[model samples]
Target chain A: MGSAMGVLLDIAGVLYEGDRPIPGAVDAVRRLRGSGLAVRYLTNSTRRPKRRIVERLRSLGFPVDPAEILTPAEAACDWLRREGYAPHLLIHPDLEEDFMDLPKSDRIAVVVGDAGPCFSYERMNAAFRELERGAPFLALAINRVFKDRDGKLSLDAGAFVKALEYSSGTPALLLGKPSRDFFVAGARSMGCALGDVTMIGDDAESDVSGAIAAGVRAAIHVQTGKYRAGDETQHDHRPSALARDIAAAVDLLVETD
Target chain B: MGSAMGVLLDIAGVLYEGDRPIPGAVDAVRRLRGSGLAVRYLTNSTRRPKRRIVERLRSLGFPVDPAEILTPAEAACDWLRREGYAPHLLIHPDLEEDFMDLPKSDRIAVVVGDAGPCFSYERMNAAFRELERGAPFLALAINRVFKDRDGKLSLDAGAFVKALEYSSGTPALLLGKPSRDFFVAGARSMGCALGDVTMIGDDAESDVSGAIAAGVRAAIHVQTGKYRAGDETQHDHRPSALARDIAAAVDLLVETD
Candidate 1:
């Protein structure tokens, strides 16, 4: 086949939920390796940096690398730079490394990054107060909900973003998946056409559906991360293949690259 | 006309932004007296305590009693009681005032509140570790974003909750909008049928659309807080009446009431 056969993977539900590996996740990656194809992992996960995502995968016995991973946060930083900040005041934990030692300001604000539950009323009051002064709301990833390894669903940055949009009546600029920009960026960086790629993961809406819309020929949805057996209806568009585990996804894909 | 014809008001966007009153908000409320109808300030604001909301409105020159206000937080608390909470962690400024007085949790982990741009990385790390244990991602009000009178937007506690959800892959229980329990509580407290009441608000989706979905027919949209000219198309369901400002909203509804 063409370079279009390159594989893209999602780790959370695909490889492992936590320390425990998914049923077929490990063999899936090993099998993809047996076919001798390039693999990439992409996730909308906004938690730990790429290093942790990789480390966690290795701990779970899945063949993964930090370089192979692309998170919405990384895309968020890139997206922010493409549209230069007005010295935006950030509301995130430890953004210093990401902001590259830029000075902080209370004057200008752009709502970016993860909204940890550690968020305070004082924080809410401060932001609300700032919004009252007319600052723009720029959210990193507007995902309303996210699921953890144990397969429990919870609110994500998007839910809070929606809340603010409703409360303040301010429009937000979303920079992550389903937005189309990140999808395009990943493709450009890969230096490949859309045909050569397969987005494999648990989330059908963001990863698979977004990849499909971005022109990927195939998207393999693994029931590994937040996706459970009964959540088929949650996806607006169906995946090219459905595998019980990650290894099954690799087997499902026709090796080309 | 019945009492249903009277003015059903919305608090946040129409009357104020942040802790300060909107420029013409108090004046508009005073003028509502001429309409010869009772002004009931209905709010979907879930963040603040009821007494605080009432106090804030009273300080802004509008006469408001505790009964005149309806918040999703109260409704959520009620729901929590009905459903049950096992000693959960809290991340708000004033826990005793918000949750401790209500029903208590057994296995609480983190208790956070507003401390500003100073959200430490250490704090976030600790929260993640506890939540990794899979305690419920609990919150009081899920509204994180806010607009000041000048319209500057910023993230609040809801955003923090969102961040945690993304990191740990857990969902939160919103004590506010989209929760039918809250609306039912509001109607119950008001001792009115959910359909007979009218909700006047400026937010296109959250307030107006929420009210309509809750069976309120008359919703007034104003360009005061989150309302702008371009907001007309954000939601398919528009308000029953459109007002340029709260003054206009009162002017139109006063006669009918």
Candidate 2:
């Protein structure tokens, strides 16, 4: 395969895990950027707005600009604007700032994210009502579970999305990771062709397998964050390379180039 | 075909639509009981305990005894006792009374029901933790939607059950309607063979098709609550007879005998 012209870097596990940056993650991004490769931050995290995510990255000493980050919330906003539909958001309260610029209209869509403790029955019912009334259902991501702040696996937005789908008898349009369009969007944002972009992340399924399925040049799986011992073998589309962490993945990319 | 020797009656739609009884439903039950057929009430409702359910039936002028009512809550309790596990109940607060008598232990099983307003992320995550730790997942019912008090379709326990299953990568054991074992238990309670008991209800899929699949003698579909036009055509197992309402279903049952 050809070398990567651009890179899609997963934010949470690859850079930091629960408020602490992975060893050498900050220097790795700088070295990769110094190599003249276009880099874009892509994340499935739905709990925070893009600004807050950028701020978090900055706090950890990563040289990231707000424009360099791409989130599902931004993609969802673009889709909402393109479709001329207003959203009834079932999302975490912290993420509300991303969709503030969308025009309000009577044609509504149900947008679901990881609402965390905000996933109340009343909120779910409200979203269900919107879907039942023929509103479009847009899900940010459908990852089944995520490592919670307490270091335990907890239900993610995907589970709640499945619930709403079951209740309303309506299928949801995915706007985040594992969606080919999401990876393509990331590639497009950096003016890179799908075949010239590589993804680096810890999640084997959504980050590695998803990028491979999306026609990226390669995906480097990192053994950090939520990576389990046998996670790499779980999906049919395996990662192109395995790295100890993002720093190791950067070394492979830089040395290969 | 042989005539029905006993009956399994669905509570919500067949007997009443919301708080109002279907026309002649009370008299129909009286006539059916007078015909010497063993009768049992089967419901999937997990919002209330058996005592409250019986109270509501009495308030509606139905001659329902608590001993004649069969609910998934009771079934779940029985199963928990048999398996020697204490339940970590993710159910409506109103239904806690039903499980209060069970012995408490660390061998916890996650029991999910229609929690209505009680479905919060904290509760769902707690249940997920139990499931992740090798706890058995028991769902009271998995009906997709239910007609709410507002006369609008709302999400039922099935939606939440699906969410937990998606998150934990575990299949749940069903303890309510549409579970063949549930129907068999209803028949067994009435001292009748499965082939000698008929089911009467409005839900084409759960009440009618479910009983048919369970090998009941017959299932009478009534056109009342939640019975949309062409519902019978939606399922592969057609009801033995279609009646305008529960009263008509009773007339058909009594006359055939």
Candidate 3:
């Protein structure tokens, strides 16, 4: 039983996509559930409301509590507020709703993302126009690309953010991934201090380093996610443990400690 | 006024996006009208039908006769056919019509582009299956990023192509941009030989060098468009001629010789 050491789950690739479950993903979740680990479904599904994310996960055979589903949108809104960046931002147009809690202004923050086609000239113009008028550019995650549905890759938000960086010469704040605050927020939202938590995920950049930065006692990296490029010799390396899959992740946690 | 040397206009940043027009860009085409220059919009608009492109350009401001538009799509399809790569496998999902002219089945030469979100496991699976079945990976432009309407840049087709590159360790046969055939296609559209022409455009990598590769007598780098880094030193350190704007471009031609 993993009740003593908690586990966090990543949704998209680890859980399900749209309606179909990834191969063997449910069994992995069930195995974790059977172990009694506190399962938090951490997701960057800013596109969907939290309810949908939870409902979808439940439908896919995962037991997810409403309070347990975490999203970057929430962290983004929180980070914006905490940092005192003016609320009204020309955020990625795709994430207009993410900023619903933030105050709005006619002027916009500088626009950037490898996020999607959302980086269109219209979105860039809106962000650039606001930035041109003295709005600061606060960008989200800057990963070069995101692994797509088919487990292949495409440029992610970072590429677009860098494009604006080259164009505007303004550096935006990063809210998620490798940013300490995201892990801090995750723990804070879980109503626990980072020192008490055991964090595990597939990405070293976001999971391990981020957890470490926020003071998580331990971090486990699963080789299956973004880090399928998982050579520890690469830059940004170092985790308490590494595993090929979720099952391996739980084993690493048990074995390492 | 431009018809004298036989105009060799570059596409990409110069003319259209996908199959659409850049804002206020119709003016360039309108200006080209009756300018007495043998005008041809030479493009690397890979994955598009030139006929459709001509129609799109006319709606945007080009007096482009469909016959006047030179595309990598045509050249690629042509190359595929001649090399007996006919009906070559197309990796890109967007412009299948471009390949329709090719010999059907068993002759599919290669697949191309970054394939976007569709570059999914399924898409890559399909490409790999074909490649496993002996299809080559053919690419059009391998641009790393493209500017959105917002002026922020996002991933280009290169990222997807790269994954396939990683997966197969096979380089793609590029069919557009810096390729020599691209420049030759431009001149061919103008009814001129490469050595007799001058190449003009914004992107130094794809346009200037491509012009040089095609044996263009000269190239002028415009600072306003694609290669505008706000700092010229970072780009191709040497431009045959540098102009800050289009008017400056015209002035450079007048003053140079």
Candidate 4:
């Protein structure tokens, strides 16, 4: 790719699967960075902190830095800090460690995600009560399912987020993939305009359509990890290009350049 | 009402609000019974067993019998028993006592309701896994909201049921108030044909339209409990009559008779 072309990469299904890295993904990242392309990792994963995700990538032999990783937790934490809001987080227990740096106060804002074992009726109702009392609702992502460690598709955070929305009649502010702000913020972190960046990932809706909607220069769909057959055809948004995998996507980018 | 005119009454909004009975509701039931009308209490309440519900109504000074009280749980339990399906109950902890009489086996069927404090990601995912494995999804009721003890509208079982449906790509068989089968079952239990029965309730969609669709002779919408000001006008199925409350509903039925 050209030196000025920035790229946003998805993590869970693109570069790695659970603790294992996708084949040729680590080399593809190296090749993209070697080509002087500005690259940032954008993810909707709410189960782990950004530091943990970075550490995981490094352990999997991928060259990922803390600054180069973008997650909804970070975006939510930033939004919370910037707005001076005290959030009542209903996220995964492992993800709670990331929001400890925010200011603590009596003000309550309801934040929801795939809380895993941490999700309970008490906590959900607590969040619902806050929403009923006019507190703001923030969602990490509405992705329906995620591939678990056992290689099985498990329910994601979207169901619970939607449940709360349906119950309270309050729309949630999505701060993760498919949300234009999350995409634009990632591009901004790379010091590039939205129109100058390209997002490449397996999830057609979250990564591809989300980036395209945010006015990113282009979005590339990779037919690896979590890429369902005919996903590109089913969705309303069209991907700018399609590749066999992350490695092929990198090659396509470079060849097009 | 005439001796042959059977009345199907909705309990939650029409006769009671949480633990407390609506003013004059007990007297209305008594008057309807005194007039020699066949009365059946059709409810969508899944938080408690039918026995407990009947006891609660009795405690609240309503002349309700075990056979006179019909709930979605009872309908669902009956359906399960008839189909010889072993049920994995995802319902309120208190409601578990109701389905204990079902035959035990390795054959897994998912039965869902307002699980209340029992609703967790693990349990929900377990149910989703069962649905994915081709188990039938049975829902007690899909009523969007219910009036709570504090008189505020609270989230009901429908939201979770819908979440599971959306996630697993499975449709739930509703065995509750809005389902025509549930309404017909109540009429059948009363030894009355569907055309000889009248349903009276505050919820327009579940009680009124549901009965009308099931071929009930008439449906009455009451302006009490959770009834919004214009709910009767907003729905496509017009209630045969509109009353101010339970007392007025009984009066309207008798006067028309």
Candidate 5:
């Protein structure tokens, strides 16, 4: 692969996993930045606002700025503004801060995320009612399952999104991972063309395959965070290369450059 | 069409809607029975137990025996007993009385129904965890939406069933409407062959199309309850006949005979 001008990095499982930073990830990120590549921290996490995510990254000894992070919530807000729609949010309470500044309007859109314990029949019905009233539906991410804090696979927002889609008969506009627009937005934020950027992450489907399908120059599959053995073989879109971790992935990229 | 020996009738839209019974439904059911056809009230309702449903029907002046109603919950219990699997039920609280008599065993099956307000994230995750452990997944119904008591379409158990199926990557064994086994079971309960039975209901997909797909002698789509003007034309399996209501459906059957 040719030298990339920018890199998109997945946070959870790539840099850190649940309050603990991956070994050598902090140094790897610093070294990669020193090599003069424009970098963006991309995540599908909807449980926290971008502020909290940046704070968490900083607390883990990685140099992160609020401006350097890209989230589906932010992307959704941007889209909502462009479309002149006010969101009737069905999202986690902790993540509500992200949408607090948006302009309120009568033109409503149902926005769904992982509401955690707040997912109830009444709430889901309320969102369904909105969609039935012809409101556009927006989903942050539609990944089926996620590794919960308890280390067991649990239902993610994608399942709830699917439920609303089934009930309302309206296809939700995806604003998060695995969507080509999300990847392109991340690349655009870094001031690079989609074909001049590389992506590194542990998740085969969302991070690697998503970037590859979005026309990224290359996507490196890293065996860290949520990655199981042979995950690379599960999807139709193969990653450009497989690395032991983000540090090794950085090494391969820098060496080629 | 050949004269039918048995009839499977959907309760909500065909016999009644919400608290009020459909006009002429009482006389229609009685007149159909007087014609010497065995009648079974088949419903996908998981919100209430069979006893309560029978009581409601009787109170509305429809002569109904508890034995005449065949609910998906009852069907599921029978399947659980036959398979020797104990149920880990995620059902409406009012419906729990129906499954109270099942034998306890170590082998567990996750049975999902319309739990109303009881569908919390913790409970859904618990069910997902059970499914992850290799337990059989059973769904009482998978109907996308239903006309609520408030007369608005609401999310039904089918959406939640899809959620679990997506998260666990396990297909649920449907024990309600649209499943061939549920229709066949209703016919067998009256000791009639599938070809000797006819179905009548307002729901085009679940009631009429489902019965037709299961090879019933005929299915009459009644234009009442949740039935919209163009519902009969929505699916490929068109109803054998379209009637204004249950009374008209019975009139057509008796006149043909």
Candidate 6:
């Protein structure tokens, strides 16, 4: 497998939903690997650290390397380190272990994601006060909604991110899916040019349209996981291919190759 | 001194700053009363009950009748009763006493205000679930920012309200200040026609512009609580007169008479 043949895979709603892997999703990844295709798991799950996420995938019988997962939290850490910004993280406690190595300073930058229980008025106000005193605002993902533990749709970090944005009159710096830079970086990490990689995801906007915008060769949108009826017509940039599930999506990619 | 010539007053930033009354506001209201002007205090303070607000005003030496205070909570309760909605309230605990008269049922309508400590991810998510199940959404006030107990600017209910609206794709029906119906109702309760009332407040949008849209005779923008520089130029509906503070606003009304 070379850079010319690679796939960027979305984890949630693509591989495993919550703790359970979608049926045939593991087999689909295995088939892609057997075909000599490069695979990188791109996720916007801000509720847990990368180590935990990798652990969950392994327990679910999926073969995943910790290094191959490109979570927005990890990307945000890399971006913050490069810019020399000290983060005042407003994220779930489970996700804080990822940034324990960063240097602490009074010069704080408000780093936020789907904090779950941590999204309190005090925490948000503290973040707002920091922004009012001239601190930058950063977000892991601005996803509107996510599947909860019970599998019902719940308010995601995007709503709170927008709240802080409106309250402080400051725009958030996005570092997750649908961000062109993040998508291109994922392609580069796979040792592939943006035009060589095929993106696969359940979300039309974040995965398919985002990969297209980032210059991916093609994107396959799956019908499972958060896909509503008429999503294909709802966007100006339609997915290059559509599949019933991860199995069908992998089959389409193999046949096309 | 009758319904033919009435004045609508705003609380908080106009008559008082936190616990302390604004320097001549007490005397200004006293003068308005002495002149036999019909006065109604229109407030969007969802943090406290109307009884507490009336008590606070009395303690500050401003002669305020309980009937004169028009709180959004009271208006919301009235609307809920009339519309036959059993609300799932997301508000400060202190304000819950105001809705004690409402009958309870499983059919929920999300009633939100400045929820203060009651604003948690669990509660917000619960509200989101209710809305997803087709519950109607209502808001007492959606003011962007409010002065906290610590005298610092804090994120108000508007941020959360907008978040819920974005998450559910449902618009919240506002029942507080800046709502045209609330304004007109306050005028009617005073036995005054909307065209005979003159509204005065520090907030340019909610108080002045709202009054103008409600067909009030005139509106005076006061430079007091929550009023920022350039607020006069920010709105399309300019105030009929500008005043240094509540005292000056009262003076303007008296001079015109």
Best by lDDT: 2
List fnat, each candidate.
0.13, 0.99, 0.00, 0.51, 0.81, 0.74
- Tens-place lDDT per residue, model 6, B73-161, is 98888878888888888998899999999976666789999997779999998998899899999989878777776877888888888
lDDT of the candidates, in the order given: 0.61, 0.91, 0.59, 0.84, 0.89, 0.85
lDDT of candidate 1 at residue B232, scale 0 to 100 = 54
**Candidate 4 residue spans exceeding 4 A from truth:** A1-4, A77-85, A100-107, A191-195, A212-218, A228-234, A238-244, A255-257, B1-4, B81-84, B97-107, B150-152, B191-196, B208-244, B255-257
The candidate with the higher TM-score, 1 or 6, is 6
Runs in model 6 deviating more than 4 A are: A1-4, A104-106, A209-215, A228-238, B1-4, B104-106, B209-215, B233-238
Q: Regarding DockQ, does 2 or 4 come out ahead?
A: 2
Cα shift from native, residue B81, model 2 (Å): 1.3
Listed models, DockQ each: 0.15, 0.91, 0.05, 0.55, 0.82, 0.70
In model 6, pairs of residues that clash are: B1-B36
Clashing pairs in 5: A13-A225
Best to worst by DockQ, what's the order?
2, 5, 6, 4, 1, 3
Better of 1 and 3 by DockQ: 1
lDDT of 2 by residue, B1-257 (tens): 33689999999878887899888999899989988889999999999999998998899989888989999999999999999999999999999999999977779999999999999999999999999899999999998888888888789999999999988888999999999999999999898899999999888878999889989999999998878789898887999999999888888878644
Model 4 lDDT tens row, B1-257: 43337999888788887678889888888888888788998988898888788888889998777988888888888888888898888998899888888887677889999988789888998898898789999999987677777777667787798788877778899999789898888889888998999999988778887778778888989998788787777556889888999899889767533
CAPRI class of candidate 5? high
Among these predicted structures, which one has the highest DockQ?
2
What is candidate 5's lDDT per residue for B139-162, written digit by digit as tens?
Answer: 999988888888887888999999
Report the CAPRI category for model 4.
medium
lDDT of 3 by residue, B169-225 (tens): 466787877777777767777777877666677766667765676677677676654
lDDT ranking from best candidate downward: 2, 5, 6, 4, 1, 3
